[model samples]
Target: MLGLRFIGQGFAGLFGLIGLFPVMAQAADSRLQRMETSDAGRGWEAVGRLDVDGEGFCTGALIAPDLVLTAAHCLYDARSGVRIQPKTIEFLAGWRNGRASAYRTVTRAVVHPDYIFDGEVSTDRVRRDIALLQLQRPIRNTTVIPFQTDNRPRKGADVGVVSYAHDRSEAPSIQELCSVMARQEGVLIMSCDVDFGSSGAPVFSFSGGKPRIVSVVSAKAEVDGKRVSLGADLAKELQILRAQLTSTRIGSRMPEGVGRVQVGGARSSGGAKFVRPGG
Candidate 1:
């Protein structure tokens, strides 16, 4: 997170550490439904609470039997920019009312190489705010199926999200109909309801009657007086992160891609977009 407040120029709220921002452009009928029981959490078993060092937490989703996807900042010390040890992190899959469908320890982790923990809150920062965690052991539970992902949808496309928040830490919740307000520089700004601990939650698109992740919640910010969640393009960014992790295992340099610099794209002057210094 850039900080706990928006500052009218840069986004500052990172979920699980900052106060919830005022509801700005949330879908009127999309109420959070807590999955406190097995039945309620049936299809969402892969959405888990990421317990970081057992002190703080964030939301993560299993993209593979042994691979978890989440926000890069969640693995870094917000104050020191030091990366947190992978051993201390735990994935409580489908945690609800003190139980989890499966529990696993993180053995290795990888963040987008361009992700700067101490960077200012800008499009560049949010565009690369993604990470991948390899579990010590693969979770083969049938019920805890890893989610499938799709490309970023066009603006105004309907989306969904599942997450654990500071208030609803015991059980995950789902908001089924948030709207993507805009897309720019590989970032998607949504009118979804996200808060502290909601970082790294998966944004789902149910276009073909199947829930496919289209974005990963990076941070929540207010845009044009309306609260919106920020995330990178899932399909593209995930590939970059996967390549980074592959290089890590082989002790080789990462391949060049969109994770680094941004090509020319449209910039918005409205408060709804990511603003640079005095932008």
Candidate 2:
């Protein structure tokens, strides 16, 4: 979700922070019914909510049974500005309202090496702003959303975004059905408005019979007149994610835990790492 507010031509809001998009509760036009049974082949049972400490949280979709995809910037240690230790995090599946249907522990995190949190127009951070979390066990939810892998919608295609943004927000709600503006660099920019808690929510275009995720919410674009947004390509990132997810051991489930460690800044900085993209 991108905002229309102007911080600066170079200021692209938070690299992984929630993009400020206007939130709206539109009618559910989706023809895709919530599946009562899990589709194992499509990796549908992996979507979950990521919670850290108590305040910092974000939405995550499952790309595999044991792997969850989200914005790399989401794992930052805002206080220390460094990467949070994966062992301290937890993944809750089918998270809605205030409760998660199923939960698991995150053993490790694999973020895009090219992910640069600095806010700059020229930097490729916005396009590759993705991260993968390996869950300790496979979540057994039956109502998993399938990833869109075929017939990707073109620019201006009607699409919807869903997320449980804010504590009050419910299941990934549909904001606005805007069209795909353009693929700036490699990022797919949309016209839909979003907010902070909606980070990592899936952007889907209704095609065939189900809503396929064309892109996952990365960062929202700002505008002076035109409203545009950008999303990391799930197709490309999933390639790297598949290799990592398979190599890692699914092993035993991790016990529930909630604590915070430093992330994203210099190891000794002891605060959120602020890296400005060089113009």
Candidate 3:
């Protein structure tokens, strides 16, 4: 139920009054490429849309054959603050024009221990806003190769993002050129174009020849008169989620008569909207 409204300069001006500074002096290129054809989206098969009980969606990435990385907020019911059953979640890899390169159900999900879904926008919430999903089956297809993950990128480093926003939900879009504006308190502020349904989208760093995930989109905010996206550093959070997943066993069946919950309410400063990735 998360939604976005572009307020343009007025939104930026409000942030300026608060003495916050724009991360990037000039706007970074965040032009999106519609991955409507296989040829156009050849190497992006690992990124996918996570469908939550047929009600909402969030962006996610495959980090291992049977493991997916996303935002922890995606796993909670925004209205009741209850955790959604994992069996109801599904991953549609390389989804494009009603088709998918691979499909798999979620067996279990582990959220960061420090993540709080209290509807507050803080460095703590943003920094710990990560989760890991264990897929029912491994995606070993040639086209759907999982991506590798690395530490957060340095400030001003060039980054990229692939996400499914409200306007462009049918097919995923890749912004090949974005910039990491700042790093603070284990959180990353980037000049990446993101909106509702883009939560949990993977932010990639191309330090090596191949693309590696560096952070996960948590929210969109106006920082010092500039529109920017907030992300969680994955290094420590990923390790915690992985350890939890390995040690715990998730139930196979879901509780009976679990209904879908709607999520939308008040907005915070900077016109910020708290999005629950797949909720």
177-248 in candidate 3: lDDT tens per residue?
899877777878788888777889999999877899999998777654467787898888898888878887
Question: Tens digits of per-residue lDDT for model 1 on 1-279?
Answer: 212234322334532232223323444639788888899889999999888655567889999999999888777655444567777789999999888999999878888878887766667788788889999999999999999989999877889899987668889999988888767678887888887678789999999999988888887766545567788988888898888777676313322221211111222211112212111
Superposition-based RMSD of candidate 3 using all C-alpha atoms, in angstroms: 6.0
Off by over 4 Å in 1: 1-29, 250-279
- In order, the Cα lDDT scores of the candidates are 0.74, 0.56, 0.77
Please say which candidate is ahead in lDDT: 1 or 2: 1
Task: Provide the lDDT at 81 for model 1.
Answer: 49
Best by lDDT: 3
Worst 10 residues of 3 by lDDT: 9-18
Best by TM-score: 3
Off by over 4 Å in 2: 1-47, 118-123, 145-152, 167-171, 244-279
lDDT of 2 by residue, 1-279 (tens): 443332222344433333334333233434222323333213333455577654445677766667777777677643444566677667777655445567778887776766665435442765666678877877656655435443346655677665545532334445436666655456666666655555676777676667677777765545535544557766776677656655655433222333343323343332222122221
Alpha-carbon RMSD, each predicted model: 9.9, 8.5, 6.0
Which sections of candidate 3 miss by over 4 Å?
1-22, 25-28, 252-279
> Can you rank all candidates by lDDT, best first?
3, 1, 2
In model 3, what is the error at residue 119, expressed in angstroms? Answer: 5.8
Error of 1 at 237 (Å): 1.3
